[model samples]
Target: MTSLTPNTVAADAEGLTLIISGDGIGASSMLQWRGVDYPIDWIVDVDGDGGSLGSAIPASALAIDGTFETVLVTVSTGGAASNPLPVTIFGPGVGAAESAVAGAGGTVTASTGRLTATYTRAAGGYGTLTAVDYAFPTDPLLPPNPISPVAFVDLQLLDGVAGDTLVGTFLPPNPILPPNPVLPPNPVLPPSPIRLAYWTGTTWAPVSGSGAVAPTFSFDWATSSASSATVTFDMTSTPQITALGGTVIAFVSAFAFEGFSAPADSDINVAKAGRAVPLGWRILDLGGNPILNLSSSSVDVSSVRIVCESLSGEAEPLDAYAPGSSGLQNLGDGYYQWNWATEKSWAGTCRLVRFDFGDRNPDGSPIYRTAAFQFTR
Candidate 1:
C-alpha cells in the first residue's frame, strides 16, 4: 500500500515537497508524477518494509509553472506498482509564496546541433555548453506509465563541483530553420519541453529525491530552470556524490519509451506442470526507430532466473535454464521466446520468469518484463 501526504497543492505552487508512505517499498523504488517519473528519496525504512518516499515538486501539477492539472501519482518497487493517488493542484492563484534563489549566478553559453551536449564549468558560478543529440524518445507502455517528451537534449556536465552548478546561459541549438523572410505568419504548435534528467542504464529519468542507479551516483538539481533559449540552473555539491562511475550525464525529461508487450499474463498459467512453456517477452519503441537499444544482441541469456512462489507464500529464484540458449527462439522484432523446463516440484506453486532488457522509465524505474505460470499438479 502506498499513499501521498498532503496530496493537494496550489495550482501555482513552487518548491512543494510531497511525501510518499508505503509498505514493501524497495530501496530502488521510484515515483511516477503525472507523465514523468521521479526518483524517491527514502527517509526511513521501518524494518525494511514501509517508509516515506521523498520528492521535490518545484512547480505543482505538470513541470511547467502555472499549468493547472490534477496529477495522478504512484510508486513502483519490487515488481509491483502501488495504487494511484490523485494530488490535485488547486486554485487559479496570484500568490507569490516562493522567493527567487540567489546562488552563484553564472555566464552564457550555447548548445549546437547534436545529440550529446557537453558543458564545461568555469571558475565562477558559470559555464557554457553546446549540444543536441536528437533522439526519438518515447514513454514506456508499462505500469505507472509516463508520457513522451517531444524534444530531448543529451547533456553532460564536465568538471566536478563548479561545472555541475549549471549556472549559465544556453543558446538554442544551431542550424536554426531558415526563416521565410517573405512568408507571412503561421500558427504553429511547439514541441513539448524536455525535463532535466539523467541516464539510468535503462531510460532517461529526472533527478529528484530519489537516488541514481547503475552508476550509483547523485547530483543536486535546481528544478527551477525553465528550458528557454537562455536558461540558468543553480546547482551545488551533495553528500551522495561518488567519484568513479559517478560522472553525471543528464538528459531531458523522458518520454517515447520502450514497451514490453509480449508473453501476456493469460498465456502463462496452465493446468499442468513439467511442460515446456514458451515464456518470453517482446520490447517495442514508440516508432520503429528507437532512441535506446532493444534487440536480441543486447540481452544476456545466461542471466535468466526462474523464481518460484510456493503455496506457502515463499518466493525465491533458482538457477534455471537460460531462456535464449535452451529451447529459445529469436522471433525477431524484439520477440525472444524460451521454453520453460517446468519441474514437477513446482506443482501447486506459482513460477515466475523475469527478464530485464535494461529498459527503465524516465523516473529510473526498471520495466521488468516477467512471465508466470501456475501448476495444478
Candidate 2:
C-alpha cells in the first residue's frame, strides 16, 4: 500500500480496457456504479445471422480517469437459458490496488500494483477472482503473539545504518521498556515478542516486536588479558551455524609470539623423548560432506593439527579435532582452528581436494608438520 492516507485526492485521465468473456450465444449487459444500463457491445460474422445477441464483446473500450470507481457487466444466456452473471468492474479510482486473473487450469496471474480489476461470476455464483496487497510480510524485532517454549531464545537486533551504535539495554516487548530500578542506572528499551538476542557493544540485548511482553535477561561478558579468549557455547545449545554477522570473537591484546620448528633430531636420551613415527597420512577426497569421524593411531605427539586445503573447496572446516581426552570437539570450536593456523596455511584450490596434518610434540621439541596433499580437480 502507498504511504498516503485514505481520503487523499487522486487523479485520473487515461482510458481503461475491460475484458469480458461469454458463454454459448448470449447477450451481455453493462451497468454503471449507481445503476445505469447500456446495450452489450456485440460482434457479428457478416455472413451469419445477427440472431439473438451473438458472443459478448471480446474487449470493450472505456474512457476512464484514475479517479473512476466502479462499473458493472452482466451476461444474459437465452433460450437454453442460464442466469445473468453480474461482473463487477473497478477502475483505478476505486483504490483497488491488486487483482488476479484466471490463466490456465484455474490458476491465476498474481496481483501487482495499481490497476483495473474484473471479477467473473463463477458457475456457482462465486467470484473467482480476489485481490490482495503485493507487499511481503516483514520480520520485525517483536511479534504480536507471545509464548516461550524453550528456556533459551534467539532475538533479532534492530537493523540500522552503518556507524549507528545501540548503547543501552533493550527491553522486552518494546525497546523502550522501563528498567529494573533496583539495578544500577541502566537505560533500557521495551522488550519484543520476537526473542532474538543482539549485541549492543558491551552486552547482548533482545529485539522487541509487536505484543512482546517484558522479560528479564541475564547479562554476561567474557574477557582476558591474553591476545584472545575462546568462549565455548555448545552448538546444540545455541542456534548459530556459521561464524558471521551479529556475533564475534574478541582479541583483547596484540602480541607476536615465536614460531616453533618441525622435529629434526632422530635420537634422544631416554628421559628426553620417545621416537616419532609418521602418523597416518591420507587424502580428504570427499569435499563438502560433514566430517563424520576422525581416527588415528600414532606413536608420540602432544597434539595433531589437520588442515583442509582451499582445494577441498569445502565450506568452513567442521570443528572435528579432539583436544587430549575431550572426545570430539564441537564444530566451530576454536581450539582446532587456532592450532591449525599456527601449524599450516591451509587453503584448498577452488575445485580440487587436499589434506595435511602436523604432530605437535610437547616440551618445546621439534614437532613434524606434514606437507599439503595434492589432488586432481
Candidate 3:
C-alpha cells in the first residue's frame, strides 16, 4: 500500500486509497481485493490494468467499526498469481489527529482536534510566544475549520533579593475583548493543570512547588486587559534556576483546547569577572571584555558601589568610586579597578557581592551584577 494517511476513516465521508505496482502481472490480469480470499465489494480500481492498479475503498463498505486487514491478489491470463499485499484499516472513532510546534522555550500539540500549548524556563530567564495557528476536519459539511486568531505570552524573570519569580502575561487568541457580551470570553476555555517547566536541553522537568502548595504559580482570568490572565511562577518558594542558560516551556490542556509556547533566544548570562586586586575588584563581560570606556575626558561616571553580605548575613556597603578616584585605578582598554581594604573583614565566609555601574546616559538603565565576588582574609 502506498499511503495509509489516517488511522480512522469516516463512513459517510472520505475513505482510503490503495496503490499497487509490480511487473509479474500482465495487462489482462484480474486484480482481486479480499478479506482472506472472500472478495470485498467496496474496492474500485480506477484503471483495470494488471501491472499497476489504484483502488479507492468507500467508508460504507468497511463493514463495522473495527480493524480490517484486506489482502490484494493479482491473477494474470497465464494463470500466474502475484504475491498478496495486505493493508490495514480502522473505522471511524478509532483515533484522532494531532499536530504541534515549539518556540524558544515552549511546545504545542493537538490531539483528536484538541489544542494544547506549554511554556517552560529551565535556567530561569525571559521568553515570549509569537503566534499559533491550527485547523480541523471535524465537520463533513463545512471546510476545514481553523483555530482562528492566535495566542501569545510575555515571560519575565525577576531575580530579586528574596528569590526568583517568573511573571507571564498570557494573551488570548483574540487580542481585543468584545465590548458586547455576544462573543465568548477570551481563551474560549481555560486550559487545565497550567503546567510550568524548564528545559534540560534534552527534556522538560516540572517546576518545583507546582501543585497544591501555597505561593505556587497561579493563573487568573482578569489579571490583564489584553490577556486571559497573568501567570506567576513562584521561584522564591521553590527555586528552579539550575544553570546559567536554558529554556522554559509551559503547558495548558483542556478537552477541546491545548497549546505550548517558548521564549525566543532566552538564554541567561553568566556574570563575568576580571583579574583580582588586593581588596579590589574588576568586572567584565562574558568575553572578558570591559564596558565602554569611563576614563576618557568626554566619558562621565554617574556612580559605582559594591554591596557585600557575609555568610552570617552581616551586610556592609563599600564607598563609591569614579574613574579618577584615589583607590580606583584606570586599566587600559576600558577596564577599571577598585580597591577597598575594609573587604578583609569578610574572611572565612561566603560573601555575596553586587556591583552597580551607572553611566552618563541618564535615559539608559544602569548596569548591575549580583554574582560578582572577591573572597578576602
Best candidate, TM-score-wise? Answer: 1
Q: Which TM-score value belongs to model 1?
A: 0.30
Report, for every candidate in turn, its global Cα lDDT versus the true structure. Answer: 0.40, 0.24, 0.31
Clashes of 2: 38
Compared to the true structure, candidate 3 yields what TM-score?
0.20
Off by over 4 Å in 3: 5-8, 14-16, 20-52, 63-377
Q: Where is model 1 poorest over a 10-residue stretch in terms of lDDT?
A: 94-103
- TM-score of candidate 2 to 2 decimals: 0.20
Report the C-alpha lDDT of model 3 over 1-377, residue by residue, as the tens digit. Answer: 22222323344456555454556433455545443222212335345643234445655455543221222333333556554433333333223322222223442222221222233433333332211111211223222222121221112122222233343333333212223345333331232213333334554344343232322223333331222333344433223322312132323221111111111001211111221222233433222344333333322223223343422332332223222324445665544444323234444333333333421011223233333233334
lDDT of 1: 0.40
TM-score per candidate: 0.30, 0.20, 0.20
Model 2 CA RMSD to the hidden true structure, in angstroms? 23.1
- Which one wins on lDDT? 1
lDDT of 2 by residue, 49-79 (tens): 4523322222233333322222223333332
